[model samples]
Target chain A: MSNPNMKLLYVVLALAILISILAPFLASSDPDGLESAAEKIIGEERFTELEEAEAAIDSPMPDYSIEGKGKLGEIIAICLGTIGILAISFGLGKIIKA
Target chain B: MHIPDSFMPLSQALIYWAIALPFIFMSLRWARRDMDEMKIPILAALSAGIFAIQALNIPIGMGTSGHMVGAALVAIIFGSPFAGVLVLTLVLLVQGIIFADGGITVMGANILNMGVISGSIGYYGFVALRKRNIDIKASAFIGAWLGLFISSIAAAIEMSLAGTFPLVPGIVAMGTFHFVIGIIGEGLITAIAIGAIAKARPDLVDDKAVEASKEVTL
Candidate 1:
């Protein structure tokens, strides 16, 4: 990559990190558009039931938070996920380039 | 929009996966052939940035919130809908496996809605508008908006097909909510991101359509 493009990547990475850290606090607690729509169609209780149904695999970081970690845990979880995605993408890019 | 596993029957999920595999293959081919070394880092940054932005859900009113899906932004930046598919597939995998933000079984449907459909519409829409001599920012905004809105409608249809939601009401609700979300979230964010990236790295953006527009205007 050129110097300018590298600089842009760094800037984007920094911004992404910042957003991940802040998201737990700033992000709305309300249901997202799809969730809200589902709730409207199926009723809130049924929607919740469906969302809570057992899945094939349980995620280590379910709902982007660690159990009993509160908001701080959420911040950590999301930030880690963000950084992990960066590393994964970078690695994938390198492998593809090679 | 991320559809949970329970919202889709196993059979329906399998069908979506079948439909999405070809697109995934094509995206991989594009990644190998079209994405050069210089663009790879940009792609990495974009994927990370998209994942981060998706974590933040800003309220769009009416008791709902939304985030940028980033499919349009990816397509427009890389100048290919395949790029959107590649990036979104990776992001969705991580989200499903680690964060559990989206479901594993229903992932195919999510990918189809947010990646293939949104990416195609967003890229083609922007190119179409730019070909008509429209401003870049305006084209991006409209394209992103249309991509998101239509994708949400598609999701509604999928949900209906899965028997999780009644058809017309599901469409009405999802359509209404995403229309508003598309305007305030996807459209604004895509336009801003495109503008910033173009300003910072003009050579990195695919501006052939812009050039074509200039030719037409001249």
Candidate 2:
């Protein structure tokens, strides 16, 4: 963080990680706009069915948490996700710029 | 505005993928030609921030919650919609594949709605507003709001096409819900983030845009 620009990057990354850590406890559990709209238009049963339908690939951390691991699990999952995207984006940028 | 796989039929999903591919290509070209070494860190930071913020949904009443999409923030900072597309595409990919927060089958539609539509509208809208002598923060707020609102409508239309919801009702519901979310979540956060970044690192942002905005204030 010697460079001012690097300092800015570190600050942003730190803030992002902090937010992710807090998200599990602070985030609302209610359905989002799309889900709410869909559930309203089509019955809740159908909406649930649609959501539960099988996907091509099963996510390692579904719903931002490890199964049966509760809020602690969510914090770990989301923090990892936040760091993962940063690393991936940085790596991709380096590759592209290279 | 993440559309799950079940919301869109395979045919419709493929159509969205067809539409999104060209934009993705153009964004890659932008990265190759226009993106310099200076922008790499900013891009990574913003992508991480967007991903993290999206995970924290705030309750917006009516038994629903919403989060900041961050398309406008990225576009405005980079002074290009392609930056929004590029970062958002990456974030959405991770969210879709790793968290299952969004669906893989309909990742194309998600990209189209959140990445392409939101990014294009957010950047262009901000520029258009600034041209009218509006303050930068205000312009960013309105731009972000408009981007999210319009993208929500686009998602509703796609859902209707998939026979998941009726067109008019879906539009009304999605539009109304996101309008509130945009105001409270997307618009406010975007304005705040941009203001903070511009204050701290004027060198990183678009010089002309920041200069013009400063001139407006002074």
Best model per lDDT: 1
Query: Which consecutive 10 residues in model 2 chain B have the weakest lDDT in total?
Result: B202-211
Q: What is the TM-score of each candidate against the true structure?
A: 0.96, 0.95
TM-score of 1: 0.96
* Interface DockQ of candidate 2: 0.83
Q: What is the TM-score of chain B alone in each candidate?
A: 0.96, 0.94
Model 1, B14-95: lDDT tens digits are 9999999999999989988988777877888999899999999989889999999999899988889999999999999999
- Each prediction's DockQ against the real complex: 0.81, 0.83
Contacts from the true interface found in each model, as a fraction, amount to: 0.76, 0.82
Instruction: Report the TM-score of candidate 1, chain B only.
Output: 0.96
The true-versus-predicted C-alpha distance at residue B179 of model 1, in Å, is: 0.3
Candidate 2, superposed: residue stretches over 4 Å from native:
A1-3, B207-218
C-alpha RMSD of each candidate structure in angstroms: 1.6, 2.4
Local distance difference test, each candidate: 0.90, 0.88
